[model samples]
Target: MVAMWSYSAGYNVVEVGDDVWDLIEERTLVLFNHQSTSDVPLIMAAFNSRPNLSNNIMWIMDHVFKLTNFGIVSWAHGDFFIHGGKQHREASLLELGSHLQKFYIPRKRKWLVLFPEGGFLKNRKASSQSYAKKNNLPVLENVALPRVGALKVIVDNAAAEQHTDDSDKIKYLLDVTIAYPGGRPLDLPTIFGGWRPACDTIFHYRRYNIEEIPKDEETLTKWLYDRYEEKEAILQEYYDTGIFPDAHTTHDPKFEPVETNRLTGQRVVHDTLEFILRHIFYIVSTWIWMSFLYWVFTSICQLVW
Candidate 1:
């Protein structure tokens, strides 16, 4: 993503709010609104300064994503993919809950990332709205109604699961609102071509302590729906103002601006020099891991032959 070497397009994918939120170090359950296939790559670029997250993060994704170009990479990275739609929803969630209970501690996963809307807004919005109409829930314009099944499963089974280490457990839920400037989301080509977004794709964050969040099914589902309501409101305001308003400042709550504790910018890894340095670091690190893999492969081949 550092390919944005041009004078005009070389802008950083900006992180706007909640500057002090410990996104990098702490164990987290992150909610991201799915836009296009490019969101994951955009996240990779966002993690330019926090490269360990790129390696260690666990992504919970739609089962259909298995057919995408990134599928095998996700599988190799150990991301979780569960089937979608009502037919398989219950079974898939039950399976996911079971898997999380068994895997979270042993896998040493620090962050769990998922899209609660179940599908992209473009594909699922109409159905979401219809369901809202039937169920008497709010019909949102920017985001589809989020399905709570997976969220519930993860919260019930994975939230507090942790290694015996004294590290802080999954203590936070990061509600991340990703805005593609001018409603134009990035595509997969950017991974190879670089971050070519004419303007920066801005990220807004709100941190909630897991201890403060509701745990029961009914309350948790209500809390998630309330969050989607806030997400839609944020999106609408972003479209109107060309900026994400700090919820604390915008007649809303928790969306504080990070003037004193900015996360990524000139202080972060956005410069051309950092980009080159990162390239060098990765080039050197590549040999370290690849050499181990090479030895493993050769040893296995010798044993078989």
Candidate 2:
């Protein structure tokens, strides 16, 4: 499905390095950088493009999965990674396999996909640095890539747990950057520019992992975060030089403080009105929906009888 969209939409994907996929094929735990929401499907298309990587991508999704129809659709059929409840902190190898097998794991290879940043981050450079520091991983301060905590989880799991004899438990970070030819690189605002609804179909695969940091579980968590602080310093230096631009660095000057009249009195009146309306609307909507459903079900029962 994603491949077909990519083919139709004319989105071009550039592979930053070939070794990235090589690590992938070798059953490495893969961590990808988060840009726009477009990241996921694009990666799916890229994975499909490779003959050897048909069904090895797994992702950890969040709670919006229940509230929206989009969530239902994305994971309805495909093989991906996910965790819920206290299970996430204590997911056993057997439990991981149970979810993993839903997507069809091979007889011996252990492959996984993850986004470590938790969710979309507005300040990628700073957030990535902080997360890296906390996890004892090196930070790519110049550019916001994958967060280290998620990678730590994968590493710790892989290191402590055993897989098949043929399975090699290695870790990798795939840093993907989205770009447009002759156009600006995609960012948070631009991707959702037109009040566009859910990104059902879009083709975009910008950056594949260029750098690889290999570490064992015991030391990886601490080592990864230390890298973030180092990355922050490097980024600060890069910003000073104007050499390569550090992403998410504020450069505009129009941002200035503005003063507003004190609104405590007016705010009190408005809040009172808003409170009344909020309850009225909530009760009204709930009653209407429930009443309509009840009538419909009653009519259906009568017709059946």
Candidate 3:
């Protein structure tokens, strides 16, 4: 459904690295900047583009999202929901940590996507800027200050837990920067309206090994702050120059276009078959719903007459 939505919306995704998919195959934590609800479909499209990366993904989202249709689907996917209210914030974090410890096995291949900023950049920008001013931190333009508590808990637990083998012990962290150059922010309404961007959506991926990150909470918090600061700089550069710094570019030789089936032999054919199956499923579902409604209407009319 996500792939079909993305394709129908005319979302052209340009990924920086091929190795990022390999990292995902390993137990990897993916951190991305939150822009809009459309980010979910775009990210799903990114994972779907690669054969190595499975769409079996989990997300860390706030309780408010659980009220939406997206939230219902996410719930089915086993996503962790955290309460954002001040009263239950600490308790929620603790619960989230415990859940992560139990849910994510070291040997399993999982992609845990985290929006460390906690909310959309546009909504949180003013508060983030005010906080930065007070703390002498750099004023973030593109992204907001990341709430590190959840990150700290996840990293600490992952580091402390013992894996089956030495290779499995080290998990990769991919800092993915998603950008829509010369385009408006994407939302559900925009997508439903079939609004296509003039330019392609660019996803910049940089990998960080788990062993490279500090395990201690305090240092790790600072590390996350530093990472966001770097993100801010990268975004600032993009806005000014209309291109990201070449130093951050991932020149993956194996990277191929979505239309190309060379990377995975039967990918294009498989995707076409999946698309057809999805349409059939939708058609059958609509027919069932309409038939039930019609039966109910006829039963009511017969009783009244």
Give the top-scoring candidate (TM-score).
3
The lDDT values for all models are 0.71, 0.45, 0.71
| Segments of candidate 3 deviating more than 4 angstroms | 52-55, 106-109, 163-170, 249-270, 285-305
Q: Model 3 residue 4 lDDT?
A: 68
lDDT of 3 by residue, 1-305 (tens): 76667666676566653246555557778899987877877777767766756544667888888998978977776688988757987999898877666665532537788898888888889998999999998888888998888788778666555654644343777788777664256776766666656346677777766667777777787788887887777767776777755434222345322332111111111276777887899899989999999999999999999
- Report the error of model 2 at residue 290, Å: 26
Writing each residue's lDDT as its tens digit, candidate 1 over 226-285 gives 888988888889888886666631212443334435444322344567667767887888
Question: Which regions of candidate 2 deviate over 4 angstroms?
Answer: 4-7, 22-25, 66-70, 73-110, 123-147, 159-161, 168-218, 222-305
TM-score per prediction, in order, is 0.77, 0.49, 0.81
- Looking at model 2, report the run of 10 residues with the lowest lDDT sum: 261-270
Q: Compared to the true structure, candidate 2 yields what TM-score?
A: 0.49
Q: RMSD in Å for candidate 1, one decimal?
A: 5.4
Off by over 4 Å in 1: 1-11, 20-23, 160-168, 190-197, 249-305
Q: Which ten residues in a row have the lowest lDDT in candidate 1?
A: 248-257
lDDT of 2 at 80: 38
CA RMSD for every model? 5.4, 16.9, 6.0
